[model samples]
Target: MTFFSCRPDTERRKVFHLLSFLFLAGFLLIQSFAAHAALVRIKDIADFEGVRTNQLIGYGLVVGLHGTGDKLTNVLFTRETLISMLNRLGVNIRDREIQLQTHDVAAVMVTADLPPFSHGGGRIDVTVSATGDATDLTGGTLLVTPLMAADGEIYAVAQGSLATNAFSARGAAASIVHNIPTNGHIANGAVVEREVPVDLANRKQMHLSLRNPDFTTAGRIAQAINGSLGSNIARVMDPRTIALDLTLRDSIPALSRIGDLMVEPDTLAKVIVDDASGTIVIGNDVRISTVAIAQGNLTIQVTETPMVSQPGPMSNGTTTVVPRTSINVNNGNNAKLGILRNGPALSDLVSGLNAMGVGPRDMISILQAIKADGALQADLEVR
Candidate 1:
C-alpha cells in the first residue's frame, strides 16, 4: 500500500523558480568562459613578411599665411627655397639685387607613407610640418613637392591646401593657441608615380611574422594553420617566424585561407607596473607562490606656525618673532600583514592583495618585493 501526497501551489512554484535560476546561472558561466578563451584571427596578430609601407619624405613650402610665415631675413633656407622655386618657374629672382621680403610663405618638411603594392596615379595623404620659426600654417597651400623614399627615388608628388585644424588669437600682451599651429595634414595630397614591385604570386614560399613573439603562440599558430589546410604545410621556424609551404597550393589563395583561420594564442606570465601613472596590469597566466606581504611607507610631516611677540603696555620689552614647528612621524604600525596562498589563478592573487587595503602603487611595491623573494612566478616590468 502507498499513500498519495500533493504539495501546495506555493511550494511547487518555489521549486520551479529554483530550477530556472540554476539553469540561467550555468548558461552565463559557460558564456563568460567561452568569451575569455575566444580565438583571434591570424591577420590581427601576425603579418606576412615583405609586406610593409615605405616612409617618404620631402622638403616643401607652405604659402598664403596671414603674416605668420617664416621671416626671410632670419631663415636663410626659406629665402633660398623661395628663390629656387621662383627660378624653376622662370621668374629668375636670383639675379635681382633687391631684398626679397614676404611673410606669406613658410618652409616645411612634407612626409608620407607609400603603402605596399601602391600603383601609379593612386593618391595618398601627406603631412606637412614647419621647419622654421613660422608661427602658424593655417590657410596655407603646399606647393608641388616630390616625395622620396629611402633609396632617393621620387615616388610621389604632393600639392594640396593644408588643414592645420588649429587656431591662434593674440592681442598686444597675450595670445592663445589651440592645438599645434605649425603642423598640418592634407588628405589625398600626393599621387603615386611608381609602384613598389612585389611578385608574391610567383614566390615559392612565404613567411609569417608574429608581432609579439612567443614560443607557445608560434606552435599554436603552426598547428592551427596545418589543421585548417593540411598536414605539415605550416612549420614553426622560430618564436617569431612561421614558414608556409606553397609548392602544393596557390600562393595567394593559400595565404588568404590561412589568414582567415583562427587560433588561440598563449602569452607569457607577466606583470607590468607604470609608476608614473600608478597603473598595474596583471596577466591571466601570472601566478604567485605562498608568500606573506605587508606594504607601508614611513612618512614625516613638519608644520611651521610663526607668532609675533608684542611689547607689553608699560614694559621695556621689544617686539620679536617666535617660530613654532610641529613634527609628526608615522611608521605604519597599523598596517596589517596579508597572506597570499599558492594559487593557479589571477583572482586569488588580486583578492589577497586587495584584502590588505592597498592601492595600485603600493601593490606595485609588493609585487616587486615578492619577485625579489622568489615567490612571484612571473616577470615583473616596472616603468
Candidate 2:
C-alpha cells in the first residue's frame, strides 16, 4: 500500500518537473524573438535637427621639436608668422637685422568641433596638423591658438602638448616610421570662450533627420514615435525628415523618450562591388529573377624546344640547330552552365550564384550583366 501511494506522488512530481521545463523553454524563445525583432533604437538611425557640431579652425605654431620642424628659409609664411608673434609679445624682432633660421618651430593648423550647447569654460579636444614642411610633430608644444568659426569670431583658445602617437628613426641610409607623424591630437586642449546659442527647451517644434534616407524607414519611425508617445505627435515630413509637434509636450523629456523607442529600420536592396579590391557586398533584401549564367576563360599555351646537330667524326659537315614549337588551346569545354530561378531570399540568390563556380571579379561581371538584363532586382553600385 505504501509503495502504491509513493508511486502516485512520484508520477505527480514528474509531471510538475516537465511543466516547469517547458515553461522556461517557452519564455526563453519569446525573449529571443523579441530581441531579434527590435532592430535598432530611434537615436541610432535619426538625429535631432539643429543639434549639430560647428567646425572651428585656426593657424598656430608648434615649438620644441628635435629638428623635425619646418625650415624658415623654405617656408616664408612660417618666418613671418613667428616674427609677428614675437612682436605682439613686446619683443621687437622686426627691427633687428637677424636672419631667423629656426628648425624647432612649425606652422600648424588647429581644428576642432564646437559641440552644440557647449558653454564657456568647457574644454574640448583639438587636432593639430602641419601646414608647412615638417617631418614630425612628436614632443611638440603648440602655442596659444585662437580657434574661430566660419563667422571669423574667435570661439576657443587651444594650447597644450601634442600627442602624435608616432615615431621616426633614421640611420645613415635607412629609416622607419610609424603612423602619421605630422598630425597630432590634444585631449581637452581647448577652452571655449564663446558658445553657440541653442535653446532646445523652449523650442515649439523640432525635426529628426534619418542617417540613411528611406521612405519605409521614415514612416516606421513616425509610427513608432506616435504609438509610443501620443497620437499625432510625430509626422513624416519627407523621406529623410520627421517633424515632431512639441507645443504640448516638454521638448527635452519628449526627445529623450522618443529617442529610446525602438523600431526595425528598413533599407533598399543594394549590391555594392569594389572592383579595385574585388569585394562584393549584397544586402539581405537583394533578389534576382530567373536567369542563366555561364562563365569560362580561354587558355593558350606555347612551347619551344631547340635541338643541336653536330658533325659525325671529322666529316666536313656544318653543325646545325633545329627549333621545335608546339601550341595548345583550351576553350573551357568542361565548364557547366547554370540556371537560377527567381529567388525569394538572399541565401537562395547566393546559392544559385555559387553553383556557377565563379570568383568575386567574375561574379561582379555576372551581376552587372544580370542588372543590365533587368533580372537583378537590387541596385548595383560599383566603387
Tens-place lDDT per residue, model 2, 1-383, is 89997998999999999999999999999999988775899999899999899999999999999999999999999999999999999888898899987899999999999999999999999999999999999999999999999999999999999999999999999999999999999999999999999889999789999999999999999998888888998899889999999899888999999998888898899999999999999999998999988888788999998889999997999999989889999988887778988999999998888877889989999999999999999999999
**lDDT of predicted model 1:** 0.92
Given candidate 2, what's the lDDT at residue 48? Answer: 93
Return the clash pairs for model 1, or none: none
lDDT of 1 by residue, 210-317 (tens): 999988989989998888889888899899999988888888988888888888888899999999999999999999999987777899999999999999999999
- How far does residue 203 in candidate 2 sit from its true spot (Å)? 1.2
Residue-pair clashes per candidate: 0, 0
Q: List runs of model 1 lying over 4 Å from the truth.
A: 1-37, 169-176, 304-326
Q: Estimate each model's TM-score.
A: 0.84, 0.85
Total colliding residue pairs, candidate 2: 0
Model 1 shows how many backbone clashes?
0
Measured with C-alpha atoms, the lDDT of residue 62 in candidate 2 is: 99
